[model samples]
Target: MAGEIPRAQPPPAEPDPVRDAHPYVLLWQWRRNPLRRRTDRLRAWIALGLALFVLLAAPAAMYAVGDTVHRHYRSTAEHEARTRDQRPAVLVHDAPRHPEPGSDEARETRYPVEVRFTGPDGAVRTGTTDVEPGLPADSTVLVWVDAAGEITGPPLTADEIRSRTMGWALLAFLGVVLAGLAAHGVAGLVLHRRNLAGWDAAWADTARRWTRAP
Candidate 1:
């Protein structure tokens, strides 16, 4: 008996309290940790609110701005067309003209088919007429020119211009909003990844401390 090695003391019985406990223990532990619990809740709520705001407000804002821009462009185009139609033709002498051949230089008669009007601000404006073969010099003729410098017999109506302008504006607004949403989603993903990394680090730290306890 003296020579025989004493039987190794039975290994200390491992605690079975946690082994039999419900899985809810882990959940309760996590919930009780102030820092971890608060951070998780705050992050969740913040993400939810941001998502809701983007979902609801983005389309509405885009629509409102697009409508405003469309209306503005349409009104401006229509008003300009009307004003051009109403402007009276003026008479001028020695207006530039294309020459015809086989005419005597000394007795050649020149007639005006267009007139130029100088505005009060010294801007020279011109009009042309197709109704008359030639407008006599110092005589008036009526004509209309559109924004693109092409002669127009009838100006565009408000409704016609609005339809086209609204279509273009809405298309552009949609493109912009979609691009913004895409960028926002990418940013959110990056932030979420960083937050996840932080959470993992905190979890590891907590676990290490728990295991090291006396």
Candidate 2:
């Protein structure tokens, strides 16, 4: 018996109280073990912070972004409307009489047509733009232009502004989530590596006694 190898003993069984409880019960580590490591406490605090941010800060950030975008776009729309003018022009030729099935006109409900309009500079300009289908030659159409006789885009409408605001809000929310996830992920990785190193050091010290031969 003196020279024989000792067999490993089974570890004591742990209590199973609340084994089926939800995993998110608050302060679980602190309550379960008074001697929990600093890393564990730090992780708990980080989780609590992230949860609070998701509930309160995320929505606030999204709304702020959306409001800012709406205001900017609205201002731009008002400025453009003030600077630009929509003038009535005569169609040089008729839009396509008919479009093939599933064609651009059929999809968009508009077809390209050539039109002539006089700008504020007293110069006539001819250009092609989309208009509703089935208009005959010499038909009156509206075109937007600046003072320089150059065709320009129409001012943003209410529907477009609302759509853009929603899009920016969604983007802002996603950005917050992505940033939070990245930060938490890095913290978790650092904590994991620290835990591994701690375990290795503990095992190295504890193993000496078991390996020592009497």
Candidate 3:
């Protein structure tokens, strides 16, 4: 009995849930854990960079678009104001209720109507211009006129410019954010595939060693 060898104890069984119940880490790949691989760290850094890029680049794009749109619309308004002016005009005929064929009702809400307006030279003039439907004959309406006394559209209002700038800026911001997210997703997919391949190779190596075991 004193010379007998002791029996080898079996390893304890590990449940999947228990093995995977590790606490969440904010940036586990950035840690110096022995299980962390070079690809893992690279993927973590890439994710961080993309997140920063989205935050920084989105606002930058928004501001650039807003400034550019504001300047262009402001200049356009100034030019139109200089070249155009409003004139008192009387409708000579009823405004057409029906929109022209192949026209969008949303945009072509107003129909063209004949109007009598005073010219730049003080002579009475007749012109066809846009007006709301159902306007009766002899109804007064303010019409825009160009330098040559021709009927024209009104200049861009402040409200219109501000709205357009805000819309474009918002679109630019969304575009930047979406682009950054897409890039990050693509990079993550690539890293995930690489990690899977490495894991497969390591498992294969382990299996081969197990087959040769006594």
Instruction: Please tell me which predicted candidate would have the highest lDDT against the true structure.
Output: 3
Cα lDDT of model 1 by residue, 36-122, tens digit: 444445544555566676676666766776678777777776776665553345665444443643446423654435566543344
Candidate 2 structure quality by residue, lDDT tens digits, 1-214:
3334344343333222257365544446546576567887787688778867777777888999999999999999998888899998889998875656567756678787889988888788898878877788999988998756777889999999999999999999988888787877788789877876776666656565556667
Judging by TM-score against the true structure, name the best candidate: 2
User: All candidates' TM-scores?
Assistant: 0.37, 0.75, 0.69
Candidate 1 Cα RMSD after full superposition onto the native fold (Å): 16.7
Considering lDDT, where higher is better, how would the candidates rank from best to worst?
3, 2, 1
State how far residue 195 of model 2 sits from its true place (Å): 0.8
Estimate the lDDT of model 1: 0.55
Please identify which of the two predictions, 2 or 3, would achieve the higher TM-score against the true structure: 2
**Pairs with steric clashes in candidate 3:** none
lDDT (C-alpha, whole model) for all candidates:
0.55, 0.78, 0.81
Model 1, runs deviating above 4 Å: 1-43, 85-154, 168-187, 199-214
Expressed as tens digits, the lDDT of each residue in 65-160 for candidate 3 is 999999999999999999998999999988765545445763458778899999888889999888877779999999999889999889999999
